[model samples]
Target: MTTVSVNLPATHYDVLIDRGLLDSVGSLVAKQWSPRKIALVSDDNVAPLYQERVAASLAAAGFDVHRYVFPAGEASKSLTVLAELVRQMAADTFNRDDSVIALGGGVTGDLAGLLAATYMRGLHFIQIPTSLLSQVDSSVGGKTAVDLDNIKNIIGAFYEPDLVIVDPNTLGTMTQRDLVEGYGEIVKTAALEGGEFWQLIETIDSPAELISNAPELSARSIHYKASVVMADETESGTRQLLNFGHTIGHAVEALANGALRHGEAVSIGTVAIMRVFEDAGLAEKGITSKLRDRFAAVGLPVTDPLLNSPQVLDKVKNDKKNRHGHLNLVYLTAIGHPEIKSIPSSEIASFLNLSVTN
Candidate 1:
């Protein structure tokens, strides 16, 4: 069992990672809060798989478990769903003392976390991230939100979880595409983390090899992100480094409209931004090519036609990173080093129009 502590100013918590950890979640959560009403929030797809096991564990530990399962997909992350979940809890007579436990992938975690943060002002929140993307990235960060008008995470808040329980065993049932979806975020994060973390990912020659190392890789990714969150909890400073591929990635994701998974869009986004830097001579040549080779080896997309669409540029202008008419773009000088550059929102068209040789 590996435990990563996220020691922030206002909230301190532990991210426990281990196979078969799901069975022990009730006891683990009991250490944080006394047995109470637990709103076990899960998506329809995941509810049938492991929800019963989780709910049983919590029930056995003396907590009243209420199951709230919604349709599973990116489209489910919206105000309509959030309202429905919130209203359901209200109907059940829930209050501040109750809790919210997100029990699925990124979409589930993001939506449920927001439900916990906003319900009755705030409630004790717990995360049982099932997907690789959720387990490694979204599950740890306090960043939570729902999409608005095609903008990703446009409405959200920084609400840290009281406890995060990660069970890599849940990943065994994921489809290959779902597994690769996570590698996109892993690659982007490892690129920013650099050093030993980057080297560990580089050694993975295929999707099989990637999954084989998921337990250790997930721990390292969370550890790196926890440090960043502690330093810049509200993204006022260095935490923006975590947005490496997200600038263009979010735009691509919005344009793809569910055709691309979040991490897949991020995979293409990373290549596009690096190409812009390489073209400007701000980064060394061949770096973009290296990314292409590595990303392709793991079944990640390196480029997409929508990247050149005017609609994508329109989406870029609305990204959350934009401030005072400029948006911050994250690029790598090398595998282990990332730097942020702010560019005028007006100039994003040219960057999007630039050819990204995949």
Candidate 2:
């Protein structure tokens, strides 16, 4: 078992990672809140796989458990789904004294955590992430939200989970695409702090391939993320470093009309940022080529954004992070170092257009 802590000013919590940890979640969680009724918020795909095990564990810990399963996907994250989730929580008689467990990937965790935050002002929650992406990012951070009217994570809040239990073995069922998507975030983060962490990524091109060899560093990614979020919890400032590939990534996903997974778009976004930086003379020699090569070696897309011009630009401009209408671009000087600049949309669009054109 491996453990890490996110010690923030207002929100402090611990994350526990271990294989077969689900069977012990009740005892592990019982250490936090004793009698809060437990609600397991799960997606349809995951409930059949491990929901019952979690329920049994919670029951053994001496709490009544309610499992609410919903269809899983980024599209399911929304006002309607959230409303239904709230109704289900209400039907379960959820209260501030009760707790909810997010028991799936990023979407499930986001929705479940948001529902917990809004229910009766606030409710206790735990994240039992089953996906690599969620295990390393969304499941730990307090940024929980549901898509509203097609905008990704449009309506969310900063509510930390009481505990995060990560069982890497659950990843056995994950697809290669999801694993690659997760690698994009991990590699981006590692590049943001290319120390031993980045070395860990370089040692293994495939995260799934690491499952049998290096589960510890896979869990260490959470520690890296925890440090970043703790320093900038509300994301009003430096926390944007975590948005390394996310800015244009979000735009790419929007351009795809939700056809691409979040991380895949992010992979493309990272390459786009690298390309623009190199072209503008911001990147070191050979750096851009290395980034592109590494990303491709991992099977991530760095050129998917070239498919559309006006759509991509429009999506990026519509992005809510563009405060003052200046695109705040997160770029890299090297792995473990980054620079955030606020550039005009017209200039960015033109730069990207040129990159796509030739």
Candidate 3:
């Protein structure tokens, strides 16, 4: 088992990663906080696979486990679903002494964590992220939210989990597209952490090879994320570096209307931003091409033909990263180094138009 500790001013927690860690989650949770009632939240897609095993484990550990399963997908992360969960917890007479366990992908973690953070003035929260995206990123960070008004994660809070158990074996059931989506985030993390890490990623040519090295890759990505979150827990400073591909990524994702996966959209967003930087002489020559080639090699999309530049620009106008109508974009002078620059929203729109034309 590989264990990484995230030490923060408010609380410190451990992220345990290994195959079959799911079966031992109950003992792990018991060590931290002995809850009389535990709410295990999962989605329909994931429930059939491991819900019983998780519930049985916790039941054996002497906790009253209540299973709450929602429909799978990003659509499930909403105010309505959150309200239902809150009502259910209330009906069960759950108190602050109870806990909530998120046992699925990013959506499950976000929704369940948000529920735990807000319910009963904040109950204990635990994460058992089953997806690669959640395992390496969302599962570690305290950022939790749900989609509202067609905007992604516009309504959310910073609520850390008491413990995070990541089992790589959960990823074996992921589809090819899901795995590719995860690689998009992994590639983005490697670019941010550059040097040896980037070199190591460059050597991995295929999705199969990447999955084969999931344990090392996930730990490295989580370590970088944990270090950044520790320095800036609230995303007021260095943590913004992690938004390398998300500014435009989120916008395009909304425009696609569920056609684009988060990681796939981010892959295209990374390439799009690099192209804009290259045009303005802000990034090194051939850097965009190199990134495009790398994304392609990993079966990630570098550009979406269905995306319209103007429509995407309209969506970016509402992105959370914008401050006072100015776009704050994270750009790379090269891999491993990211810079946040403020540009007029109009200028960003023009750049998106130019990227489409070129």
Candidate 4:
């Protein structure tokens, strides 16, 4: 078992990682929270696979478990869905003493976390992140939100979980495409850290190898993210480094319109922005090539047709990171060295090498 502690100014939580950690979630959560009614929030896709096992574990720990399943997808992360879930919880007569457990991937975590944060002003929240994307990234961070319109994470809050339980075994059920999606985030994270970790990622040659090493890789990501969160919990400054590929990535994701997964879009976005860095001479010449090679090694796509779509430019205008007419983007001077640069909205096309009129 590997544990990463996110010691922040506001609160602290432990991200526990291992194979079969799901079986121990009830006991693990019991350490921090007392026995109470648990609203086990999950998606339709994830509910059948492991929800029964999870519910049994919670029952064994003497907690009343209530299952709430929703349609599984990015679309579920919205105010309308959030409101409906909240209304259900209210109908269930839930209150502060009860708890919320997120039992699936990123969408489940975001929805459940926000539900825990806002329900009756706040309820105990625990995360049992099933997907690799959630286990390694979204589950640990205090950021929780549902998408508003096309904007990602637009309506959310900084709500830390009381505990986070990660079971790499849960990833075994994922499709190859899902595995690649998770690796996309891992690649983005390793690119920012840029050293032995990056070298290790480069050494990984296949999806099987990635799954074999999921626990160690996830621990590294959690530790790295914890350090950043400790430094700037509210994303005031340094935490922006974590948004390494997200600037262009989010725009690509919005434009792809469900054709691409979030991590896949991020993989493409990272490649796209690295091209900008290379062209502007902000990064080494071969950096983009190296990144592309690594992504291809693990079946992650490095390019998407929508990456060059003019609609992407329009989407960038709605990005949450924009200040006035300038967008704050993470620029990689080299692997492991990241800097935040502000580009005027008009110049974004030039930054992306887009020929569209601004």
Candidate 5:
């Protein structure tokens, strides 16, 4: 078992990672606060697997619990679904004293967290992220949002959770593709941290092996994120480092129109941006080659077959990270070190063209 604490200016929370932490969620929530009602928000795919277990645990702990399940996938993370969740809570007379428990992947966590943050003027939020992607990244951070008009996370809030319980056992249900997609985020994190972490990741061959080594690797990733979030809670400064490949990644994701998974698109974006870094003389030679090999070994796609460079550029121009039409991109001079640079949106198209040609 490993515990990572996130200390912020407004509040502090602990992320507990272990093999069977889900069994102890009742006690964990009881220790925090006593609520009149609790809402368990999950997606349709995950509800059949773990929802009953989580709800049973919470119910046994002497709490009134209600379950709200939505259709699974990124498409569910929208205003219509969010509004429906809010309506359900209102119909149940749920007040601010109630709490919301997110029990699925990144999509569940994002939607439920937003529900908790806005319902009845804000309710307590707890995260029990089941997917590797959510457990390692989105579950810890306070960033919550749903896609607006196919633009990812354009509307959201910075509402922290009361506690995060990560049970590796839940990952046993994930498909190989889901697990591999998650490794993209793990590799991105390793690239940002560099040094021994990067070296360790370079040797990883499979997601199962990575999960077997989760205690050390997960802790390292979580601690790095905690440190960054602690330094810059609202993304005003240093926290931008976390968006290492997201500027390009999010654009590619939006362009895929739901065909590409978030991590998959990010994998392609990571390679594309690193190529740009190399061409600009900001990165060492052969860096892209090394990363491409590593990404391929882990079963991630290094390039987008359906990639349309012009459309990708258009999507990036509308990215939330852009400030008044200028893009602030996070680039790496080396593994584990990242810097933010501002470039004209027009220039990004040319840079990506160069990347695609090379």
Candidate 6:
């Protein structure tokens, strides 16, 4: 078991990760100051698993717990749902000192964090990430938002959570699709941190094996994210590295109308982008092929047949990640050695070709 503390500007919290951390949540919540009133937010899918236990923890801690469960899946990330969530908070009469705890995967963490950001202008919240994707990336960054008009996370805010509780045991119930989707991000973090960590992950054959008792690996990934976020909170410059394959991935996701999970699309996008690096002679050694096969082995697609679709190129050209018509491309020189480059419109099709094909 390894415990990592994420110290953001507004609030500081600990991420407790291990096989049996869920059973200890009550004691953990007890140590993190006392809030008289608390709003516990989750979706239908997650409520049955841990909501009762989370609510019980708050109850034992003497908090007035108000539970709200939204619909499950990525489709629920929208304005209409967010409006109703805010209404629920207002209807419950929650105030500044009171806190909201997001208990679910990425979808729940994002929507709940945004609720904390907007309620009465600002409030406190905690993140209990059930899925591996949420546990490593979305839950800790304070990047909260809802999707708008098919664009991923178009409406949102940078609201830090009061605490983040990551229990790997919670990942026991994840679907195979969900676990593979998360491996896309796990690969992304390894790229940023270094090749050594990436190599460590390569030895693990399945998502279940990797998430088993690997708190140190998980915490190390979060630590890399926090260190980068602390330096580039607004994502003005340096943090663009985090967008490695997301540019094309988001475009594909929007076109699919949320058909593919974020990490699933990213798995394909990362492979596609890495091929671009290889074509340009910018990539180092075997990292690209390794990434492609590793994610594929876990059920994440490395190639998108949809890449041949006409709209794919158009959407990439128009995505917000573009700057004055130039696409901000995060390409790899090698695993752990990332470089950002601007690719011309004329060359995008070639990169798209490599990215779209297996």
Please tell me which predicted candidate would have the highest lDDT against the true structure.
1
Q: Give the residue spans of candidate 3 off by over 4 A.
A: 351-353
lDDT of 1 by residue, 65-160 (tens): 999999999889999999999999999999888999999999999999999999999999999999999999999979899988777788999999
Runs off by more than 4 Å, candidate 1 = 351-353
Model 4: CA > 4 A from native: 355-358
Score every model by TM-score.
0.97, 0.95, 0.96, 0.97, 0.97, 0.94
lDDT of each residue in 280-354, candidate 6, tens digit only: 688886778978877866677777767667787888887777776678788788778889888787777776574
Candidate 2 — worst ten consecutive residues by lDDT sum? 206-215
Candidate 3 overall Cα lDDT vs. reference? 0.87
lDDT string, candidate 3, 1-358, tens digits: 9989999999999999888898897788889886589999999999999999999989888899999999999998899999999999999999988989999999999999999999988988999999888888889989999999687898899999989998988888899888778878888888888988888888888888867888888899999999999999998888988998887788778888899999998898888888888788998888888778878897899888645567777777667877776877888898887888888877776666557435
**lDDT by residue for model 5 over 210-265, one digit each (tens)?**
67876666677888899999999999889988888787788778878888888898
lDDT of 6 at 265: 83
- Clashing residue pairs in candidate 6 are 272-355
Q: Could you tell me which residue pairs clash in candidate 1? A: 194-336
lDDT of 2 by residue, 1-358 (tens): 8889999998788899888887898899889888768878898999999999989988988989988889878888888888998888788777778888999999999988988899898888889998878888888879899877658778889999989998888888877887677777777887888888777667776555646633565567788888888889998888888898887788778768767888788788888777778777887666667666667776888777344576777777778887776878888887778889888876777766646323
Query: What lDDT, from 0 to 1, does candidate 4 have?
Result: 0.87
Candidate 3 TM-score, true structure as reference: 0.96
Evaluated at residue 306, the lDDT of candidate 1 is 88
TM-score of 5: 0.97
TM-score of model 2 vs. true structure? 0.95
